[model samples]
Structures are given as structure tokens and as C-alpha cells.
Target: MLNPSHLHRLFLYGSILLSQVLPLAAQAETPEEIACYNDVQGKVAWNQKGTRTWGEDNARNLCKGVVQRAKRISCFEAGILSHNNWSKAISDCAQTGGEAITAIVPGKQCIYNRGGYALTVQWYNPGLIVFNGGDADDYSKYSTPGTPFRTEKIALGQTSCTDAANRAAVVRIIGQGFLNEGITIAVGTSVGIGTGVLGAIACVGTAGVGCPAAVAGVSVATAGAISAVGLALPEVKEIAYIGVPGSTNYLDFSGTAWNVGISNKVPLSQTRNFAKESAQTVASSIKDFVTGGTPGPRSITFNNQAGYVAEMVVIYQIYKDFGNGTIIPIPVTKSSGQISLGFSKHIDIPVEIANLPISVFINGVGTTKNQILGATVPANFSGNRCFKSFGTIFNPQSSNCN
Candidate 1:
């Protein structure tokens, strides 16, 4: 017979093996692992692989949330404050237009598109048919778990999210859309989408029949709310915005949204979005807010420069990065709305954060014909944050990145 000590030893070994095997699901989401998942939300592209290993991922991923399509009627005015003293020591700040009051005013329809999915219907209402779509992975779909689906819905600015209107269903929820998944189409609506990607040009009746901006499998979003939260992270990893540090990683892009910036040889916008949503604020992610639903822009004339821009917004404020995804927005200073921008008038917006470096965000809108002719901006590498050390150089307590 085996001695008692030998038996005890065997039992211990067996127990260790069981512990490792049994808690696979539990350990898969340990405090460290959960932290890693949350880290990648703002730093990694939603479509790209988030983690190769928990440690490698955790050590690397950092920052807040994502950016979105027009997401707001995100006009030039919105990027600035209606009033501000423009001082790092001063906390005076306020949003312009929709940012001033998103509760219900200046209605902007937004539509999001899910790239991969089996089938799903976000909402079924005929009242508001303005189209909009966005990528959704965290939400549970019947056939797929983490795979994102192209979803469509009417935004909250409407009479009511659940309220109905006599309008026809502009966005369709057919069983199969471009990728054979659920789809939303906003027909004649406008505003609340910035990126130039979209599925079909929005027409009157049908979705695919006619759709709208944000290049197809469109990506461009925003948050109606803004919070001057600090990035509160370390600079352990070379400070990446959406991906890594590089001029090409400009910011505010999803799916192939980078393509528009590439083909034009310009950076993306200076805008960054909230990667997720919170009870206190509304983010760009569709899962956080089920509500939705436009596309417009054409021609080009920056300060009378037929081909390029001449002026820019020197003031800037670092807004919160929710959970949707990251993006590039036009550069601006604390004293924003300083530039009176009109469609086709070229302007420039530059920024310098925390004495790190200077980045630029170009501005200009075009006619309704040349949909992708507006100005572009790149991510503020100077503002690329990754750690959360309290009051450290990497952690400024306010929107004062500079």
C-alpha cells in the first residue's frame, strides 16, 4: 500500500491540475484579464485582434473609449465651446449647438453598420426612417457571440426612441443585407455622422435601394455628451492613439475608414470618441445606446484655397474617450468656435498637448456632390496616453493636455 505521505503528495498534485483546468473560464477573466479587455477598447481597433496574451495585451493597451460617425451633427461649431476663457488654469467650458443640449434639439439622425453577423433587428418602427449603422461585438447576437453585426436604428433626438411617426421605414431590417446580416437604412435624414464611409446612398424608400455617408460598412460616430476627464494612464507603451504611434494612425477611423485618409494622403480628423458608454454620458458605441440615424459634404474651398486649407483652430480641449472606438478630429483650442466655418470654406486647426508635440486637424466641408472632399486631421500623438498614474506627467487632472 502507498504510504500516507505519498498519497497526500499525489492528492496535492491532482488538486493543482484540477484547479488549473477547472477555472479556465474564471481565470480567463481575472482582474488582470478584465483590465486587459477594457484597455484594448480605446487603443485597439474593434476589428483587429485585441490580445495575443493577457500580459502582453495588458502591458500594451491603454486609454479611454472610441470615436464615431457624425455621431453628433458634429459640425465645426460643436467642437468648440459657445464661450470660454481659454486657460489651462481656467475651467470655463461649454459645448456649441447639439453639444449644448442633446436631450432634444437640432435633430441629427445616425445609422450604424455591423460588418459581420448572422441576423439581428435593433428596432422596428416606421416613424423615423433616417439611416445609420455601427459595429457591435459586445452585445450578444443569437448565432454569433463577439462577432459585430451591422445594426440600424433611429436616434433619440426624434420624438421618442420608441415613439412612432407616419414616415416609412427608411432603414430596412431584412433578414440578409450586404453581409447577409441585419441592416438599418435612414433614407432622407441628415446630420449625426462625420466619417465619409457608408453602404448605399440614402434615397427615399429602400435601404440598399438607396442609403447614405460613412463609407459603406460605414465608420464615423460621436457622443452627444462631453466630459473633461483626464486620460489618467502611463506612457509605458510608445503612446498609441487607436493603434500605434505613427502619422498614419491619425485617429477617428474604423473598418476601412483609414482608406479615405490614405487615398487622399491626408490624416484623419482630430476627433476622438468615447469607446464605451456610461449612465452619466452618451458614447458612440451602439450597444450602450440602442437609439439611432445621415450623409452630406462636397466640393472644397479652404479660406479660398481651391486645393488646400489656409487657416486652422489653434485652441483645443481633450474630450473624454468613451468605449465606442478612437478617431481623428480637427484640432482646436480651449477658446473654440473662434473660426466661423461654412461649407466649402477651408480652415485649419492645430494643437499642442502637455508640451509633448504639435499635431494638426484640418477643416473644410464641401458641396453635396463630392461627399469626401472635406478637410481631414490626424490623431494627436502628443496626447497618446496609456497609464493611470495619479498626478504624474502622464496624468493631467483636466482637459489641459497642454
Candidate 2:
């Protein structure tokens, strides 16, 4: 038999154990464990800056999202951008009245060698066809505008053209140059450079086809849409929108989109896509509002002490976490567009306390978590949010990182 006091003690001890175990047990299934980890400490690539001094090699990956095959070709055509002498090559080809190469499809041919000291090859076999097949006269099949040739002769010419087109496609896709558009062909269509009908060329005993640029005139209106409210969660920022077109994700406190924390959350399919959409949104938005939105020569500065990477990311993150109200009424801004709050110089934590919630006390004095203003956060770090003194409607602890 147990005394009343003993029974009370047993109940109290059991209650304590149950309380701790229950929370942990319940927490096991909660979405909270799929956490987002952030801590600043990575280096920003120097070429990632917008300055021309970064040069070609460095600029390749930096301007990847902003610069495309067509844009690269246009840059070369304009003469300000230079890479692999391709622009010059295209210009030279253009001057000769050769058409600009367009899209390339891959196909193969069997080169038949005629017996004797002389060499002859035949086309018509299974192989990859390349886009951007060059001039129409370049192919051997048709002699003139109305003339049709024998199968053996046509095969030989196609074999030759296939080789040239294939090589060109490799160079175009891999090289830092502009991609050509496509032209109509009797069989269907073929790609070409600059502009004109595609003629297969004979070089290296094979014929090749030209391919068209996959992305042409991709506009803001065409991209898919995303919900802004669902993306407010920190953990979801990493995985949700990085790859989907028109998806939303917060710019980290550090300005760069390709951060460790950001990348870890991105799925394999969306890595390049998320970066592309983000760049387009920011660039297009700025262009709409600012006269010369290029903002040439933007520099990225890292913080040595805390390992913050660049200024743009920090400012962007600030806007993502807290600047929606600042630019709402502005004429040029889109409803989905984000606002920019000028960079801060303070390292005090950034908190979202709209209705003034409870205060956090360290030792009896109130203080917040550390956050740097302006730029220089590490790639891994998320924006600094103070301890969430719990209580309030919809103000969960996850909103503010301790």
C-alpha cells in the first residue's frame, strides 16, 4: 500500500519522464528535423564580380545565367566581348555570303572508300547529326537550285558535310560563342549561322547538320509562376524553388545565389535552372526601374572575421527576409518583384518583430544573435536571427533562429 504523498511523488516523477519522452517522440515525426543549416564561411569567386577585369575564363561561369549562346554571339558581333575568335570567324563567314549556322541535329554516315590511289566516301548510315550545317552549297547532294543528284553522289556529299557540322556543334556548345539559328530544309529543317539556308559541307570525309539555339527569346511572361507565401519558411527556401522556373527562394544574407547552404538544398535538376530564373528576375526587374541597370563593375567583398562572402547577397537576403514593404508603391516594381533596402553597416541581428513579441534575455540583459550588415557573410551562413522568445499568433520558434 502506498501513502498519498508517495503516490503523488510517483505520479510526479512519471509525469516528468513522460513529458520529456513525449516531446522527443512527437518531434521525431515533425517536419522540423528536415532542417536547413546555415553558417557563413566560404570564398566568393573573383570573376563572379561584374567587372571586365575578371576576363574570359573567370567570366564564363560568373555570367553563365545572364550570358547565353545568342547573347554571346551578339556580344561578339558587337565587338565588346571576345572568346575563341568565334565572333571573328562568324563575321568572316558572313562577309563571304555564307549563312549564319543555326541548330544542329546529330546523324552518322558510312564513308565508302573507292578502290585505287584515289579515296571516295559514301553517306547514309546511323550517326549523330549536328545542327548549324553551314551554307546550302556546302553539301554535295544538290548541284544547283533545281538539280538533283544520284544517291551515291548525294551520300558522298552528306558524309562530308556531316563531319564539318558535327565538329562545329561541339565547338559551339562547348566554346564560349554564340549559337546559330535554324533554316528550312527539304527533309525538314537544319540549323545555320548568322542567317540563310543550311548547306552541308564536306570536310574530314563527313557531312554534319547545324542545330538551333534551344532557348530563344525566353520572356518573363512565359516562365511559370510561384506562390510567395509558401516559400516564407527557411528550410523550404533551400529545396523548393532553386531549380523550378518562376519559383521563389530567399536570397541569402550574403548576396550570392550559389552558396553552400543554397546549393545543398537544390535538387540535381534545378541547380542551373534556379540560378537562371533568379538572375533573370533580378536583372529584368532592375532594368525596368533603373535607366542603365547593368550596374557594371559590381564588386564582391568578403568579411574576414566572420567569413561572409559578398555585399549583394547580404542586401538581397535582407530584402528577402524583411524589405517587402519598402518598394510596394514604386511604379516599376512588379507585384512579385522584391524591394531592395540599402545595405546595413551594423552586425546586430536582423529580426522580424512586426507586432513586438517577447524579449530574449541573456543573463538578465536582453540581446540578439549576431548578423552583419551590408556584405561579407560566409556561403554556409543564413541571416542572423535572434532567440525567438516564444508566444504570439503564428510566431513559431522556427521563424527566428537561436
Q: Which candidate should be chosen as best, given TM-score against the real structure?
A: 1
Cα lDDT computed for each candidate against the true fold:
0.23, 0.22
Tens-digit lDDT track for model 1 on 58-114?
A: 222221011211221122212223332122101111122112111211212222221
RMSD of each: 28.1, 32.4
Let me know the TM-score candidate 2 reaches against the reference structure. Answer: 0.14
Q: Return the TM-score for each candidate structure.
A: 0.17, 0.14
How many angstroms is residue 181 displaced in model 1 relative to the true structure, after the best TM-score fit? 36
Tell how far residue 28 is off in model 1, in angstroms: 5.6
Model 2 clashes, total count: 73
lDDT of 2 by residue, 1-402 (tens): 999999999999999999988975564311111110000012222222323233343333222222012222233334433334433533432322111222333432122111001112122111111111234222211111000111222110011223222222111111111112221112221222211212231111211212222212210111111111111111211221111011121111111122111112222232233223333322222221211122212212111111111121223222223375663211111011111211112123233312222222111111132222212323233433221111111111111211
Off by over 4 Å in 1: 1-5, 20-22, 25-210, 217-402
